[model samples]
Target chain A: MILDLHNHSIKSDDGRARVESYCQWIRKKEIPIDGFVLTEHRQYDDESDYRALEDEFGLRILKGSEVETEYGHVLVFGVNDDLRAAFDFTRIDLPLATVLEESGRCGAQAVPCHPGRPNVGLCAHYETRGVPEGVEIIEVASGGSRAGEDEAAAALAERHDYAGVGGSDAHIVSHIGRCATRFPREIRDEEDLVAALREGGFEAVRWT
Target chain B: MMVEFGDEFEFQPDVSMPTVKSFTTEATRMDFWRFTDHEKARELGGLPGAIVPGIMSQGILAAAIHRFLPGSTIRKIDTIFRAPLLVDSSPTARGVVTHVDEEEGTAEIDLTLVNEAGETPVLGTAVVEVARAE
Candidate 1:
């Protein structure tokens, strides 16, 4: 199964493409991916749209939010919709550890997004502290720029022996499927996807 | 002709200020960008859940300086982040004209970002090269 673990839709404050637009592009390009996860920013506001597109496209659609934490951004997957509502999108008081614990309690795996991008939100401490449990993967691809940060992140994942995932982190139609992770195992649900990531059975690929 | 260093020109704070809304609304919204994470921003001692992109603040500072130093271009600005500008927080760019060198065609400005609580989030100095009107 192939998965684009990191991506953003128009629901994100800075995204420029809608879910439907990406769906069409995916079909047009005949991309070989079994699932796509919509990791919107600040908050998760496109569950219905994601579900609709998933059903129409026969793709496994996962809903997740890139929760902004004080230490950095963590991708929270498998959280209940109700729990999402209670999330304080504007609060920056919680520590990175607390945020990770909350994400797990909410039935989501807290995966750190990009960890190296200059003055961007990279949890350098976490990287040095060693990979925490319940944190499944490291994002290796973001946008189209294949800068040294991604390479360094890839190296970090290898050194730590954690699951390394890649996604376009696409905010526009042109960026979907630009980078993705292909898993050898079949993923029937979100849990399966997480398991695949944790076991390191996926390969990161970039499509032209 | 040259005059005494301190007597040749005067320095004053630019009265015009740039609002937070003007910067956030007008400038490009940073998303999934590494340096602008809402969470990591906090860890870095930012008050908001996210870090206001330094560039955004820099742009606003540029605008504030533009008001007083007309026809001047920012040569370089060095800023130190004392505090993080949180999301949705209203911060204003305040500048004080510190030094003006007419012979060198330059002006030195001290810039700061003041939030609602009257705290300075960032403090820095910027040198502007002004093109005197012909």
Candidate 2:
């Protein structure tokens, strides 16, 4: 199954379209995908309305968030109420290890989003603190960043042997699916995606 | 000329808590985006100390543009985050006019948010309407 593991909805400060808007566009364009993850920036609150749209489109809808940690923006998938209680995500100064530890406790997979996107990226910061453990994947490609940056990140991921992923990082309707990940198995929910992330059965691909 | 290519208008933004508190996001209060605490900001960006938000710097630049070309509309702002603007030392936002079209009545401006140490934290370009004749 194909999933654009990253993108933002109207829930994000810079994003324009709502979660449903993304689902509608996918249906209209007949994009070959089973689902996509909505990774809102610095926030985590998924409404039930999104699930209904998931049913309507016959596609799985997963919840994720692009958290602005002290180091950089980190993409966290499989968030749960228990995990939220353990960590304060609203603050932008969360330490990198804290986030990963919490995600681990909640069975979530935390990947640094766009590790090469300038100041907000974790790639340079990694030079200071180095890559932490439990980080099995990294976003080597992002539609929202520079092309050279994405290529450089892809090379870094290759060198580190970290499973690479890609996303459109879309803040609007037109910005969807410039990059995506193809999973080897079908995913019906967030649990499956999390498992897929850990087991390593995905490949990052770019269309635009 | 008053409006030469390298001509610039500069101002120091008020970083006081009360003043910054008055500035809110387009959507919600979002105070965390504005509040300045050196230790926290340093922890956030791994910088030297307390630094202002890049968005807030952009906001100050937008305000400067509106003040310069009164009653004019700002069309676009292309900002590239260069460094973190330290908060303890006063930071200045400058708008340098690059090109002006007499007939079009539009101005192309380059902006820099620089700290007291002359470090430019944010560099951006703006397209704005200079003015129109009656």
Candidate 3:
């Protein structure tokens, strides 16, 4: 199963695409993916109901978040009450360890994304502080990354032997499904997504 | 002309309903219902009236900057729209130069558009290339 693991809708401060627009684009383009994840920046709107759109589009739309940390931005899946109570997602200076370890403890996965970009990516932080302790998954292919950024991120993942995933990191509708992750098994929900990341049966893929 | 740090400027553009509708309509091509139809906007959990599109708010900031720095080129402008600016509201676009690189002939400016209620609906940073000395 293939899924665009990172996306942002109008809820994100910088995101321009609407939720329905993304689905419409994906169907129109006939992108060969089962679904895409809505990884909004800073905060997750758990109250957002996409059931009707999902039914109409025949796509799985899961909710996740892209949050800032001292080590840069991390994509978090399977956010729950415990995770929300522990870390305020709005704080840009979240501790890397807490984000990674606490996410794991709360049955979630926090993967550092765009690891090649300057300030926000993990490559710069790794140069200063090596790899943080619970970082097992790295986003190697990001659609929003500039020319050489994705290559650098892939190299970092290779150096650390971390399982890599791909995401569109799409803030706009036209860019959705540009990159994705291919999982060995189907991901029915956020729980399955977390399990897939931890199980190591997924690989980064780019859509042609 | 060398752009200096802490150089500030302000502009109060026309944020009236017709102006907002014209800008919003032209920008979105009338495809975004929330910006064109008040009833659709309200039904979709948006403002009671059409709101100024965020891109238009950015455009307002860009226009303000152009007025302040006449011959300068805006290399990049990254903005975050914090709140919605209603069509009928009045807003003041203000800019402050935060950094200046003489060798590169560039300056970084922080920009904001504050509504009548003193709430900043649009805030951003812009990198502009100052016109060199003749």
Q: Which is the leading candidate under TM-score?
A: 3
Best by lDDT: 3
For candidate 2 chain B, which ten residues in a row score worst on lDDT? B19-28
DockQ of each: 0.02, 0.03, 0.04
Supply candidate 2's per-residue lDDT for A42. Answer: 82
RMSD of candidate 2 to the truth, in angstroms, is 12.4
lDDT of 1 at A150: 75
Off by over 4 Å in 3: B1-134
Q: lDDT, candidate 1, residue B76?
A: 77
RMSD of each: 16.7, 12.4, 18.9
lDDT of 3 at A60: 92
Across residues A18-123, which tens digit of lDDT does each residue of candidate 3 receive? 7886887788768988899999999988989998998999999999999999899999999999999889999999999999989989999999999988789999
Model 3 vs. true fold: TM: 0.63
CAPRI-wise, candidate 3 is: incorrect
Instruction: Give Cα-based local distance difference scores for all models.
Output: 0.63, 0.74, 0.83
CAPRI-style class, candidate 1: incorrect
